[model samples]
Target: MKLAVLIHGLLAITPAAAFAGYSLDVRLDRSDGFYKVGDETVCTATLMNDGKPAVGEKLRCTVKRERDILRRDEFLCEGKAVTVRASMDRPGWLFFGFEIIGPDGNPLQGEGIFKHRMKTTIVGEIGAMYDADKITALDSRPADFDAYWASCRCKLDQVPLDPKLTEIDVPRALRGKVKCYSIEVRCQGRTPVTGYLAVPVKARPQSLPACVDYLSMVWQDASRTVPAEMASKGVLALYVSWHGLPTGKTADEYKTIAQTWYEEGGKAGDTDRDTWFGHDMYLRVMRALDFIKSRPEWNRKELVVRGGSLGGIQSIAAAALDPDVTLAIVSVPSGCEYNGYKQGRDAAALYRGKEAVARIEADPRRAVTLAYHDGVNLAPRIKCDIYVCTGFSDELCTPSSVFAFYNALPATTKKFMSTNPRTGHYGTTKNTAGDKRLSDIFRSVTVYD
Candidate 1:
């Protein structure tokens, strides 16, 4: 995207002596364009002062999607030149507008509307694209065995589990019948993770079945609230944080962590260390499970993992990675196949690499590395019962991705429920019905004394 500006002079005879002045003009290059979801695109805006040039000015570009502001980039104008580049990581309709402020800190009055037209191309495959291929690949890789457990044990040795419960204030909603506590666990790399623990106040402390709940894309902290309605039914709910639970700080700290994680290339070791977005987040979910198993207060026999959206993806992935988790429930999970879902020109916009699927097909490691973080791959690895929910109206995470994962599950006890098409991503209470069903399934499968 590019913007250009021009200036025209006007002379007036009746205004205090002969006065002449020029009005600023601006225009952007590639005013209207289409991009693939997740693709990054650059736009440059140029401003001219009185036909010469204006240097050392400040430039600001504001991007909006629907009514919500997406991102803003502010920069110091270089001698007669300034360019602002922005990338859209998620899929959605986006609108962009820019303004150049002179050194005096006033908007350079311009004569142009300064408009930008945005379009999107849906890219990549969901789960259904390579179902058979993935299944075949898993089959060739010797079935998961006791040896795998040994390898995992060795890996666990590197990361000692510290299971410590810190008494915390329970939500007013859960104060009476359910007591809430926060648990902190240490991961292999000294990564500290915190999760919420809710136990029925009336229930005995020993040998109680526990449910490990992974939070959505949002951060989880002490103040985080769980549906007390579920705890009332005799389940010990553990709300695990996906983005390393936040410490008790101001709201600004929480917002910063959420946005900072995906700034440049993603987090460490995975892709672009400078950029803090990618699949490494899934590993954090696995670590949360490790924490749960390390706990003596929670029964290891009836472990359950559940979440929605990104959290849903983690739940499915955790169940697949760890056999100790006996049950899994996921709703509207994201991150599926890379090549299959990303397709066409718009798809190319969403990705940082090449556009053609054939190019990716020949050497898919680059894309596969990214997909390693996807829940689709994790779903088939789960050996226990699984429950999945899909929303027909979900725009952020398409129903196709959800179905792809649901169909890919190797678990014989897997079940799926879909909400009415009228509902979208916003309203999720209806999906909780599936959770109740899952609770029932968990009870039926266990022979509790």
Candidate 2:
């Protein structure tokens, strides 16, 4: 399939102002930055001072195969743009990143040039993907992948699913129109599935379609209290938090928990599949689906799952693990093609290359356990209509890995993929149009009006 046209038009100059009236603009020979294997991709890097070409400026440039460095050199901006050419023999990405350096071999200092806290000093980048659709998971699907997940389902079945619902205040406009509550459901894990549920106050039994919204990885409290405005259109909306921690907790409480998670990290229990952190995460996903289906107000005809980044990962799991899910919308999803780094592509799991490989090599069980959770392996069983949005510029969940997941989906599954070349991860840039498109799809699936 050809790259989305909407993505080609999204590329533009960097939005931030450069320091000391200096700016760097990077561009690819082809705006979309897609190429066939063995095709050379050229990146033009230009430096400007007060909107004019900064002649005689020195640029330190590096070409990388994902995170692996390939070449590093210096170029002179002699009243024109300097070019760097790179290519990949296999399906993957080649990133050409450059920064302005002074004659003293030190990076130029200015207002936006140095961000101490972020540890990111690079000024500009051009990312290119070669034969992206041809990329696949480095590791084969374990033979027991199905049997393992089936056992997880059976284990979750034994849990009581004792749901607790507490009425909560809604925005003034929704006071009479919508009934909102804080909901918790017991599952097989140490924590319960917790989130906010919004239902139309006047809906009759089996009247409204259901939507389960997954939040992106959250470390602090945010306004996850309300559903999209469309929830009032006769949709039963459940906003599930990834961490089963209480909703609306004091800031300090959340801070303490986040610190603990940060230090322990997501890979804490990966050695054994049964105790792997992902095991409990999937359990919560299955239980959340159960809780939504249990609602008397559910129409029993339509169920939608939607999220971005980490939430996207869970959304994929939800649809794959449950046959009831009719639609899934995900963007910039991580946790895909977990072992891709072994093939020189970036790993989309919680850890990076060497560390991730070491864990798998150290224990045969880890390899099997990770395959069970890899999105590429799970994509084939989704069987639901899917809408995926990705950013070619995203490093956390690289475009190559996202494409691998998309390619793994069954040919008969109704699906669409859209992208923005300028957006990265989540906050680096926003895809307003793509977001609206996804919202429209969600509304179509659940909106009663």
Candidate 3:
């Protein structure tokens, strides 16, 4: 997605020390303002400290629903000023306004209306078999796959790792046996990407396996913590971020540009710029691998990449394009069968351009472009072993898509594990059981005598 720049001039406020005051600003950075039934929309509001920057201990932004489209009945927001935190939920638009309540009992309000739309394809009550069959046909041909990825390759020379373009530093607060570092990898474009890297202090030479995780909507940052349990297992972990994250103050802060990247039609000659969604992320993952392989302490040959949701999607893509990736563990990944998935759905509702979807569907070329980034397409191309885990209740990523990718795996050593979780889009209570099984499987396949 193209990054959005907030054009509102800064509002500077000065207040007398004896008096207390507050101000609220409501502006839509970029809003088409219309949505279909099932689409997800993000609206951002910036609240400025207009009064004596209070000595308050707490601040909050509450989104209250005014209209109930898509039956979105909740409000979710995470993080404070200057940090981009997010409230994770299924796809839908927010219909409420935001209010900030200060510690001293002062309330500032910002109000706006937004809508969410559903893509056209999945709108009706069609059976799963029809949807599955349509997707299978669209995704089946290898030729279609080749055409989609034709332009996605970055010449080995184009991979951005110049010391001049990127910077690496270890935070003093993180300095210790913990072994953590902050990395800023500059994309050729205007936006600079940043992420965190951590490794176990105690790891055997060849056993220092590394795992690179691609974050979802959240940006990569120091505050982001990986489960200590994973690190304790002697695996080096890196979190690569997209959007304004790892840098932006709020997930909503990055929504403008994020939406642009997935805009309706192919802008100019760009058939599928969204392909870079995985390409750029995978590039950063590989760069993290480069950093780990450079360390005398790590085992360069034992590298694994895993993620759930968006990260899961990247894991599969990276494994497909980069032969060095030894193992991939993916869960509930999005962006599998675009055309098939978007059919019958309102274009705006699907977070895509109506004209764009129509154009892509009419022309086989667009499907060709999608093939390069499709995890299902890449799954069969991965040379290494794969462990796939999917939740039966996942809504964002249908169980059918996960099974499609799993069945496509060309690796003879691949394994499949399904969890019938009552929850949607998350691993089961047996996640630990699944992890142990994966670790054992990796040891069996990759460990040398």
Best model per lDDT: 2
Error of 3 at 23 (Å): 40
The list of candidate 3 runs beyond 4 A from truth reads: 1-154, 163-175, 186-193, 201-207, 219-223, 227-233, 244-248, 252-279, 341-359, 362-364, 426-434, 438-449
For each of the candidates, give the backbone clash count. Answer: 29, 0, 26
- Among the numbered candidates, top TM-score falls to 2
Model 2 clashing-pair count: 0
lDDT of 3 by residue, 1-449 (tens): 11111112222111122123333223222232323333433434333343323233233433322112233122222322221122213222222223344345543322211011221111001001112212232444556554444344454336555422122334454434345556565454323446666655555466666677767534334233662234444566666674323442465555554566533322333355444333455455445555545555556676677777766777777777667788777666665555434433222112244555676677665555555556667766777766665443244565456656655666464554433322235343133333665578445433212
The whole-model lDDT of each prediction reads: 0.50, 0.75, 0.45
CA shift at 396, candidate 3, in angstroms?
A: 1.4
- Residue-level lDDT tens digits of model 1 in 206-296: 4566677776655435333662444555666677666564445455666666575544333334332112244445556677777656555
Give every collision pair in model 2: none
Cand. 3 Cα-lDDT: 0.45
lDDT, candidate 1, at 201: 69
Instruction: State TM-scores per candidate.
Output: 0.57, 0.88, 0.56
User: Candidate 3 — worst ten consecutive residues by lDDT sum?
Assistant: 121-130
lDDT of 2 by residue, 152-255 (tens): 89888888889999888888877778878788899886578988888887778997788888877766432345463446866888988887778778767877
- TM-score of model 3 relative to the true fold? 0.56
- Candidate 1: regions farther than 4 A off: 1-153, 172-177, 219-223, 227-232, 258-269, 272-279, 342-365, 411-413, 427-429, 439-449
